[model samples]
Target: MLYAILAYHVEDEILSWSPEQDAAVVAKVIEVQAPMRASGLLGPAARLDETRKARTLRGPGAGMVLDGPFSETKEQLLGFHLVDCATDDEAVAAARKLRAVNPSAVYEIRPVKLYVPADGFGTTRG
Candidate 1:
């Protein structure tokens, strides 16, 4: 099964990190992911840009365009990692490894139903 591990953090706190601090945190995360990556359990991962640059399209037919994210929570969705695992326990263990590196961030793990267009986008994961 494939899982999505969502990373959430306070936007303000993350934004406050200096370049060096950011690099150090990222390095730690990479270190934790090394084994998983080598084992082919880890797939794609990404860190999103600041929310201030985000645009939201909502309402009927998703026609309305709004500035910034629509979340009211203190923490924002900072990024995600796509991982392949045999069981829920395996996925949770992967999240635990990530949490050990960045204890301040929150991780939400969920199973994924993937789809890829047939017009050359790629193959589906079903």
Candidate 2:
């Protein structure tokens, strides 16, 4: 099974960190991800840029372009990790490892249904 691990954090709090502090936290996260990467259980993962740089569009047709994501939440979606796991428990375990490294952030684990052009747009069987 494939899982999507969504990372959420308070943008303001994260922005308040010094460069060194941010680097240290990122290093810890990388350390936790090392085993999964080596074992080919990890896939694409990324940390999103600040929401200030975001844009949004809603409604019909081309939609009404908006300035930012404007998400109505205290914590913003920060990043995500894709992983291949045998079961939901395995996926939760992976998220737990990440939480151990950065306890402040929240991780949401969800099963993924992947579709690709080469796969004729059919959902890939996990």
In order, what is each prediction's RMSD in angstroms?
4.9, 5.9
The sequence of per-residue lDDT tens digits that candidate 1 reaches over residues 17-99 is: 99999999999999988899999988878899998888988889848898979788899999998899999999999999999
Off by more than 4 A, model 1: 115-126
Q: List model 2 lDDT by residue over 17-62, tens digit each.
A: 9999999999999999999999999977789999898888899998
For candidate 1, what is the total of clashing residue pairs? Answer: 0
Worst 10 residues of 2 by lDDT: 115-124
TM-score of 1: 0.86
